[model samples]
Target chain A: QQQVKQSPQSLIVQKGGISIINCAYENTAFDYFPWYQQFPGKGPALLIAIRPDVSEKKEGRFTISFNKSAKQFSLHIMDSQPGDSATYFCAARPTDSWGKLQFGAGTQVVVTP
Target chain B: DAMVIQNPRYQVTQFGKPVTLSCSQTLNHNVMYWYQQKSSQAPKLLFHYYDKDFNNEADTPDNFQSRRPNTSFCFLDIRSPGLGDAAMYLCATSSPLGTSGYTFGSGTRLTVV
Candidate 1:
C-alpha cells in the first residue's frame, strides 16, 4: 500500500511565483513530515520539515504546513526561482520507527523565467 | 563538512554479475540506510543498520544484502544483477538523538547491462 500520496506529477511556475505541492497520508503513526529536493543525478536533500505539533514552519523561502488531524501536509516555495526547479519528494517517519521513512511518488517542478 | 559519502557515482554491471556498493559517513551517526530510487519514482528503502544491527525491508529481494562492519562503513551486495535492478542507490545517515532527519549522499547510479 502506498502510505503517502502526492499530487501533480509535474508543475510549472513563473519565476517569483509561489509554487505549492501537497501530500496526504493515512498513517496516523507518522509524526514527522519532511520535504526533500533532488536534482538530477543527485540524492534528495532535506529542504524543510515539520512535526505534528506545528501547523506551519517556515525557513527562508521554503515553508511546510502540516495538519495532524487531517493527515496532510504541503510545501510552499515563495518566490520560486529557476534554482528551485527540481524533483521534490515528501516523506514521513513514524515516531516508533526511527529509521524507516515512507516517501511520496514525487513531483517535478519547473520554474520558467 | 561532516556528511554521508557514496563511492563510484556511476556503476555498470553485466546481467548475473555480482556487484557491491560502498558507503561511508563522517557524521558518525548511529543509523545508516540504503535506498533504491528508480527514475521518477520515490526512493524505496532496502535496508538499514542501527549500529551494526541489520534491518531489511520485508519486501526487499533476497538478492540484495547489506553489511555494516563498523559505524563508519556500510556495503550493499547484489549477488546477481538483473536489468530491472538498474536504479540510483542512496546512502543516508542519521543520529537517533534528535529529529533533524537524515543526511544523504549524492547516490550511485547503477546500470545493469
Candidate 2:
C-alpha cells in the first residue's frame, strides 16, 4: 500500500507563477517529511524538509507547509522558472526506522516561459 | 564534488541476463539504500545496508539482491533481467546519525531487451 499520497500527477505553470504540490500520510509515527526534485536523467535532490514540530519551513524560494493534525503537507515554489521544471516527490520517514523513507507518487511540474 | 556516484548511467541487457549496478559514496555514510523507480512513479525501496548489516524490504523480489562490502561501496544484482524490470535504479546514502537527509546518485537507467 502507498503510505503517502500526492495529488495532481502533473501540473503546468507559467514562469513567475506559483506551483504548489500536496502530499498526505496516514502513519502517525512518521516524524520526518522531505521534498525532492529530480531533473531528467538525474538523481533526486533534497529540496527542503520539515519536522513535525514546525508547521512551516521555508528555504529561499521553496517552502514546506506541514500540518501535523491534518497529516498533510504541501510544497510551494515561489516565482516558478522554466528551469524549475522537474518531478517533485514527497517522502516521510518514521522515527527509529533507520532512515527508511516512504515516498509518495511524484508530481511532474512544468514551468513554461 | 560528487558525493554519491553510480557507474554506467545507462545499461542495456538481454532478457534473462544477469546484471549488476554499482554505487560508491565519497561521503562515507554508514547507511546505503537501493531504490527502483518506474517511469512517472515514486521510488520503491529495494533494500539497504547499515554499515554491514543488510536489511531487505519484505516485498522486494528475491531476484534482486544487494551487497555491501564496506561503508563506501554497495552493489545491486539482478539475478535475471525481465522486461518488467526495466526501470531506473537509484542509490542513496545517509549518515546513521540521521543528521542529514539522503544524498542520491544519478540513477542508472536499466533496459532489458
Candidate 3:
C-alpha cells in the first residue's frame, strides 16, 4: 500500500521534444508528491512537487499533472534538453509520517541532441 | 548555501568488515533520513530520525544501524557489510512540517569487495 509505481523504465527523446514520466500510488493518505532528478554520482534533488489539492503544478520547464481520484501523477518536461537527461523518481510523502518518502523505481530519461 | 553534506564520496570495504557513512545538515531541519540505492533501483528507506526519536523500517536488515547523537549529525553503520551491501547511501533532511521538500546530500557510494 505504500508503493509508488512508475512506468517506462527508460525514455529517449529528441531535443526540444516533450518528455513525460508517470507514477501511481496505492496509499490514499499520501498528500505530498514530489519529483526528484538524479545525475550520475549524485543524490536525487527535488525537481518539482504537487499536493493533492491541486490538479497541476509547473516550474519553468517542468510540470506535474496530478489526478487525485485516479491516484496517479505525471511529470512533463517541455523543450527537453540534454542537460535534463537523468534518473527521475516520483515520491509520495505519507501524511502521518514526518518525512517518510516512498519513491518509485525511477525513470532514466535520455535527451538526444 | 545551506544543504546536506556527506563525506567520503566513495568508500570500499572488505566482506564482513565494518563501515560507517556520515551525514550532516546545515539546514537545521528536524528530520533526517537514510536511504540505500542500488544501481538502477529505487532508493530504499532504511531509517529516519525525527529530532532525537529514531524510526526504523520493518524490513531493514539487522546489520544496518544508525546513530544521531545531536541535531546536526547522523551516521549509518554497517556492522558487517556483504557484497550485496554495495550501493549508494543517501542522507536527506527535511523541516518539521516538510511542505517544501527533502534536501539530499551528494551521497556515499559503498563498494563491498
Candidate 4:
C-alpha cells in the first residue's frame, strides 16, 4: 500500500500558538519520513525530516516526532506565526524505493493573528 | 544557492491541445520528480528520474509523458489537455532516490479551457 494518511485536513491556530499535524503509514519498510511546506503557487520545500532511529528532531521552530512502533509521525510548529500559513505535507519512503515518496493528503494550516 | 527552476509559471491550454512543462536544477542531483496538486489537496507524485533512469507510477495516466534529456533538465508533457489536468505541476530534484528530501521548483500552474 502506498498511502500515508494525514489528519486534520485543515488546521487553524492563533499567533504564538502551537500547530500540530499528524500522519500515519502502513508500511514498516518506510525508514525515512519528511515534511514539506508549500506556499500558494509555489512548489513544496522540505521543512524538516526524521528517521526511525530518532524519536524527535527540531529545526528552528519546526519539529518532527516519530513513533516507529506505531507507524506514525507528527509535525509540531512552535511559536506559530501568520507567515507559517500554508500547506504542509508528510511523506514516507522505503530505503530501497529510490526516492519514491508516498505522500499524505496534506494539511492546510492557517495561523490567524 | 542550489535550487530548482521552472519556466512559465502558468499555462493555459484548450481541450485536445498539448502542453509541456519544464524544470531545471542547479543542484546537480541525480533524481528528478514531477507532481500534480489540485487545490486544497496534497501533491500527488506522478513519476521520477533516478539519474538517467526513469520510474513511472503505476496509476499515472497514459496522457502524461515525461522526458529527461540530461542530468539537469526534465520535462512533463500532457498530450491532450483536459479540464481534469488543470492543476499545479511541481518539479523536484534530489541526490538519488534513497537520499533525503528534495529541492523543488516553484511549479507550473495549468488551466485548461
Candidate 5:
C-alpha cells in the first residue's frame, strides 16, 4: 500500500502566484515529515521539513503546514518563481526507524513566466 | 562541504546480466539507503544500512542485494535484471544522530534491454 499519497500529479502556476501541494499519510507512527525538491538530471534536495510537534514551519518563501490530527501536510510556496519549477516530494518515516522511508508520489510544479 | 555521490549516472545492461550501482558519501553519515523509483512514482525504499546492521524491506525483490564495504561506500547489486527493473535508483545517507534530513545522490538510471 502507498503509505503516502500526493495530489496533482502535475501543476502549472503563473509567476508570482502561490503554489500549493498536498500529501496524506496512513501511518501514524511517522513523526518526521520532509519535503524535497528535484530538478531535471539532478538529485533531490531538502526543501523544508516539520516535526509533528510543530504545526507550521517556514523558511524564506517555502512553508510546510502540518496537521497532525488530520494526518495531512502541505507545502506552500509564496510568490512562486520559475526557479521553483521542479518535482516536489513529500516523505515520512517512523521516528525509530533508520533509512526506511515512505514517499508520496511527486508533484511536478511548473511556474511559468 | 560533504556530499553524497553516485557513480555512472546511467547504465544499460542485458536482461539476464548482473549490474551494480555504487554510492559514496563524505558526510560521515552512519545510515545509508537505497530506493527504486519508476516513472512518476514515489520512491520506494528497498533497504538500508545502519552502522553495521542491514535492514531490508519486506517486498523488495530477491534479485536485489546490497553491500556496504565501509562507512562511506554502498553498493546495489541486481542479479539478472528484468525489464521492469529499469528505473531510477537513488542513494541517500544520513547520520543516526537525530531527526535531521538525509543527503541524496543524483540517481543512477538503469536500463535493461
Candidate 6:
C-alpha cells in the first residue's frame, strides 16, 4: 500500500563524491514531488521540490531529476559532505488530495571523510 | 522567523495512560498535519486540519485523535498509550495557495513503558 517506493535503504560515500537516491510512484495523480532531509532528533526539512511540468530542479548541491512518463524521480547530491549525512525521504502529493503527502521508505546517507 | 513549534520534545508514559502533544505555528498556514514516524522509517500521516475541517487517514487508529481549536494551534491526543504506539510525532504546516512546501516542527518523541 506504499504509494511511493525508494531504493538503497542505506548508503555510504566519500566526501566530495556524488550520492544518488532513487524513488518511484505508481499514481499519476501525484503532481508535487518534494525531498526532505532529516537529522537525528530533529524534524525533516524541505531540501528541494519539483512540479511535474519540469524535468529537473536544482538548488545548489541538491538536484531532483524527475521523469513523468516513467513515474520515477531521483535525488543527486554533488560534492557530498559530512553535513549532508542524514536520512532522506521522497514524497508525493496528489492534485486533489488537499495537500496530503505520501512518503517513501526513506534512505540513510552517510558521508565519510 | 515563521515556523512550526512542537512542545515537550520528549515524553515517557505508562501503558494505557493518555497523552497529548501540542503544536503551534506562526506562519498562519491554512493546513496543518500530524505524522507518526517509527524508528528508521518514513513518516505516516495520521490526519490533518484545513482551516478547522478535520481529515483523518483511514488507517489511523481509533485511539488517536486530533483537534484544531484555532488556526495557530493543533493537538494530538492518544486515548491510550501502548508499547507499539511509541514513535516520533511530527507536525507540519503549509499554505494551500502556495507551492513552497511544508514547514515541520522538531517533533515529539514518545516513549511508552
RMSD (CA, Å), each prediction = 1.0, 1.0, 1.0, 1.3, 1.4, 1.0
In candidate 6 the C-alpha lDDT for residue A107 amounts to 97
Off by over 4 Å in 4: none
lDDT of 2 by residue, B7-75 (tens): 889999999999999999999899999999999888889998989999999999999999998888999
lDDT of 4 by residue, A14-104 (tens): 9999999999998548878999998988888899999899999999999999988888999999999999999999999876676878889
The two-chain DockQ for each candidate, comma-separated, is 0.80, 0.83, 0.90, 0.84, 0.68, 0.78
Two-chain complex of model 4, DockQ on C-alpha atoms against the true structure:
0.84
Candidate 1 clash pair list: none
Candidate 4 residue-wise lDDT, B1-113, digit = tens: 88899988999999889999999998999999999989988778898888878888899999999999999899999999889999999998877545678788999999999
Per residue, candidate 5 scores C-alpha lDDT tens digits across A1-113 of 78888988999999999999999998558878899998886778989999899999999999999999899999999999999999999988776664466788899999999
Alpha-carbon deviation at A51 in model 5, angstroms:
0.8
lDDT of 2 by residue, A5-67 (tens): 998899999999999999999855787898999998899999999989999999999999999
By DockQ thresholds, what CAPRI class is model 5? medium
State TM-scores per candidate: 0.97, 0.97, 0.97, 0.96, 0.95, 0.97
Model 2 residue B100 lDDT?
63
* Segments of candidate 5 deviating more than 4 angstroms: none
Point out where model 3 deviates above 4 Å.
none
Residue A83 miss distance in model 2 (angstroms)? 0.5
Candidate with better DockQ, 3 vs 4 = 3
The alpha-carbon deviation from the true structure for residue B15 of candidate 3, after best TM-score superposition, in angstroms, is: 1.1
For residue A107, give model 6's deviation from the true position in Å: 0.3
DockQ class, candidate 4:
high
Q: What is the lDDT of residue A53 in candidate 1?
A: 89
Give interface RMSD, every candidate, in order: 1.3, 0.9, 0.8, 1.3, 1.7, 1.3
RMSD of 3: 1.0
lDDT of 1 by residue, A55-110 (tens): 99999999999887889899999999999999999988877787678899999999
- Best of the candidates, DockQ: 3
